[model samples]
Target: MDKHRNLDCKDIEAITALLSKDGEALNYYKTNGAESVGHAFMIANLLHLHANVSEASLFYRHAFNLHGKSQTEYPLPQSLLQVSLLCLLKAGQPVPEEEIKELEKYAPSYANYIRGILIAWRGGDVKEAMSLIGNAFEGFHSGEEIDALYLEIALKYFPALTAPITDTSYSPIPRHLYMYWDKNPPKEIADNIKYHQELLGEDFTFFNQENAEEWLFEHFGSETLSLFQNTKHPAESADFLRLHVILNNGGWWLDADLRLKSLEQWEMLSRLPKNCRFFITEKFLIHNDFFGTVANDPILANALLTCYVNMLKHHGLYIPYKTGPGVFSRAVSRTVYSSFNHDAPLPSLAIGTAWEMFSIVEEFEVTYKSGGNWHTA
Candidate 1:
């Protein structure tokens, strides 16, 4: 309230300039004793929000350390205390053991929740994760909001890995891409997992209907065909069975709809017979926008039956995926006539009216017959 007090304001400006630099405020707090809780917590929050994570974690420790605690003028909903620690944990900042001891002086349950957070943060245990969330709020549903934010932090910070797509319970089957996902994780958790970033490629598979599967088993024998995920999308699912396929690996691609009296009937399987890289199906007629259902690939067949609402990325317009080959074939049209297969017919049913890439499909023996009543050998 006096002119002499105005003279002290200039020192504040000089210190403010160094705020961007780490440890500056902590050092100032050590020397000047910071006057009040507001200044110290503000400095700590600035570092936590702006500095790179490791630096921020160190700064946060210092902030809590120097502020000398008991900042709450009023008690938060009993649970938000747990929520607070969850946020700190998600931020990759550990609550100090000394602070934990101090909090225990007030409430034992909250301290227990902090312990749970530490355990869940160290080892990914769902029980600990849920318990920490349960202990985070008292009256209202702030626990839900905290859990949501914490999960957002993990998902944003860490790559999501969901329940194993399949635990076929066997050793490595056939896969090139290992898709690891957690439905959603805390955002900060992603920042801590720097080693996890990688480009994910497509996993191609094919599926057939139950009758189709019966037909497949009847004709090819179970030994040659590996049955995976019975729900459908077999064409795409088949590829995921091995996890991922690298481009140009010798994997034979086929739509489940393309039936066979015998697997040995097609000579294409003979020349490039390897099961690693993805296989191009009996080339479609041409990017015809045809549905695979006509062809009988239940994988595509089932995908068409989904109730989730919309086709976000692949907004291809087609009546039914029955003629997917025709649609895809039209996309890249190349007639693959096999001099080897005595019965190789022109791809009439698989032909697409609007195919763009129809010129370069690899030549191989895949028979396509115009629709007929008789399903013959």
Candidate 2:
């Protein structure tokens, strides 16, 4: 397997730097001192990684403009054009019929895969789309990682799959309040952490970046560390990591933006009947951002985390669904299925009233340049 398969933020940054420097590598099709198509493709890939779809499409278009649309003499040029078209289509932009007409002209074999995904996206049937894509690519065994991302995208668009839980059993309340940061968070985020720690008092252990990293390595080993680090989206990485923490160590997990309504509310939550193994906030559908579970909780520890880890390994990495709320939402819905459909109930599950467990105080003015929208205050 390729060493670059486990690409992390650090690796991405290094590749970007190399591509930027003069005489580094991959400067194909430069015209009259203008940026080369190869350079544009590299930039587009970076933007894609960051989930900046709008900007990525612009760069993709720029690359296509430098090279004629119908050229298939080289693999790199054809791949760039394919990605460019996909990005535009995925963004819900109007793709010229001419562009669609040219897909098979370039990569005849790969065009079917593209067509399958596009048809699925248009029809709004994620399952159908996945089936078509699987068939198109011969069961998706060779490019399993990319296939995983395709499944995640399908899940994000059409997310109606899940089962519900009637009740839950909670025993000992876990004292761990786990949180993580890719870097030192903003001042507001820092203040939010301090305030929550004070309210939770001595019982809770606030696992910051260092603490979280140390504990992750200690318990899960280096493989877990690489998996966590290789996650293309930091917010998704954090989301998946929290599930693992609760599964392994049992605890309450909260996004940084979430705040308690009052100290009394926390007291009440702490004293809730210790029967439910998993507690989640919900109005109608379950909110992915905040939740709680004890160590070795079967639903979270086994099913939910298992599903997430498998998806991550198989899919490699993706945005929106795979690394975002999509996976969490699917997991919650599956918990419902496990509770009702299975002859044996999966685990004790409870839904928390929104404001009582935590209040989402939306801070509109401050914006986060990175991470998920839920991470912003």
Candidate 3:
């Protein structure tokens, strides 16, 4: 199950059947009394992949209990416990005191981190929760999953703590709009681009495979050029490009598929306060796909710096944490925390309520005659 193969419908059906109560695999295990902690853990992972969070949480708990009671010589994998705790948290299920105590016995720092997230989720002391989360970043050598999860928890629960102090002294984000595609874009994407151009007129700039590299080389030099070239997917490359472009040019970076919901939304963008970075929050995570900021904004700088650092340390790891939303969210958190603690001068960051104001064309609605989905790539 850990093997890296793209799951097709048949594979999904088989896995679903195996986990079903009346299915042959589950029935056989039940009849033979052959269930093991390892098997249950596998079931939990499958459930998680299928997005059955509640069911996955139960399976993870079952695995944890089984591991504790079994006589197997192999020590329990720490990840099983950690992921179980995360699954429970994400499912909005209660974590037993005994389970938390067990986690504390094994990894005290991580236990504290989990407790911090729980505190924030439950609307306890905001300052204390932020402090614990900040400390957890320092205490643990977290993997990409942990980093992403931590950022999501912090942003979702303590958004105010992660927003930068507004400095009205800078300059307003320019009305310019930027978007990119790897090659010849599909009709839907092209249509969306045209629509934005109709709104912004000559302020709109589109980058493609031919001109995007030249632009990167001219603005950022060879190292950035090399990094852009080495990106594992078109989406990752776009992630790298958008940050640099916005940092240097100071304008709105819109995904190719995005368009304004109405003229009112366009007016809304125009009405945003000057010298402040603007972003939309969907489900508490700050989206990088469509953000506007002044040139050389520290938040954008930090996000780009994070991308470089993650690439150097964990090249080609998870894209979101490596160069996408995960790292961007961290940059926002760090900037806000620094301002709060040190009273540093920084631009005010505005987080809008929802992304629905700007419509995103669903991937399914477009036929990709050229470059296909970047994730699968």
Candidate 4:
């Protein structure tokens, strides 16, 4: 008999509610495999969230095993399988060759990434692992939570993966601050932009919805404008626009929600070597919220844009990634790789801050809170 078939609506509801109660849900699910494969998957997600890698892996294995007994669909099985490998990596265990090979049937592209990550993590090559993870997200596009989990797991093993750079060898890039919004800004966002503009003086440029669209059309013509209009995700368009504008006219690109902490922080970034591509690191992944480079760095940013354009075509302009940080990081990784072969010596990509240097003073309704609710505050 299929044990999971015995689960009732009440049992499913109870299992789901336990997710927010920490140890309660996981414990209940552990003792009650009859609770359903869905419950097992939920518990695995919770365990991953709490950074309980070993336990999460166990639950993920449980969920994966239930496939023969249950009716889970396509991508779910593939995602669970891939994340199990991540769980093993996070736990500091070498992923077995068989496990990587098994997942290859479901995701060939992902299989390659998992293999690369396995080698990198097992060999203690954190930098390569970081790049692989970033590139993986570019093609993956599952969910932000899964991406965060992957990043958290990598950071657990390599804490210095995003450590700050104190070297003063970098040149000063454009002093300009560039930000854009497709809609009217809230009071907090406007005030924050105003504050930065005041500090930066003539160097600040705040592009509103029309201004940004007009700038896109003016610079790239009707085809790019059509692409921007066709993309359903605001964040994707914002990300694409940011990189294009920065590549065309080099300067600082800060997310509207991210604010500079102080003048001293600005000064620190202002003094960096100008031509290098500077990014702010958060945990293991480079954040798209803050980064800058000198204008038109020997066709490097153009190459990055070309990569992104290709991604847009391949992914059909998806949200939270197709043109967002994942794509940005992937493009940077490719640029870095190409620079090695070419004598043009493309500007290097470096993490400028060890941790997130700016503060997100405003809260969005879409962002998840610790209490398992989306905060509108």
Judged by TM-score, which candidate is best?
A: 3
The TM-score-based order of candidates, best leading, equals 3, 4, 2, 1
Candidate 4: regions farther than 4 A off: 1-43, 66-73, 76-79, 92-98, 104-172, 230-234, 261-268, 297-318, 335-347, 356-377
Instruction: Estimate the TM-score for candidate 4.
Output: 0.66
After superposing candidate 3 on the true structure, give the runs of residues whose Cα lies further than 4 Å from its correct spot.
1-18, 21-42, 50-55, 58-77, 90-94, 135-171, 262-264, 274-282, 339-347, 355-364, 369-373
lDDT of 3 by residue, 218-265 (tens): 998998899899888888889989998999999888787666665555
- Go through the candidates in order and give each one's C-alpha lDDT: 0.32, 0.53, 0.66, 0.61
lDDT of residue 280 for candidate 2:
32
Model 3 root-mean-square deviation: 7.5
**Alpha carbon deviation, residue 74, candidate 4 (Å):** 2.4
State every prediction's TM-score relative to the real structure: 0.27, 0.49, 0.73, 0.66
Clashes of 3: 2
* Candidate 4 local lDDT, 107-209, one digit each (tens): 6656767765676656656555554554455455433333453554444443343455566764557778888767767676777779888877787898876
Error of 4 at 186 (Å): 2.3
Model 1 per-residue lDDT at 284: 13
In model 2, which runs have C-alpha deviations exceeding 4 angstroms? 1-171, 274-285, 303-317, 343-346, 353-365, 369-377
Cα lDDT tens digits for candidate 2, 1-377: 22321223234455445345333231421222225566666666666666566556656655765665544633245565566667766688655556556656765544655655676657666544554444332222222233334534433433422223222333355755666666777887777778877877775556655666787799889877776766655675676677777778776777776655566545554543443333333323345466667677655544455345556565643443454454444454444434433434444455544443344222223346544455321
RMSD over all Cα atoms, model 2: 11.5
- Report each candidate's C-alpha RMSD, comma-separated, in the order given: 22.9, 11.5, 7.5, 6.9
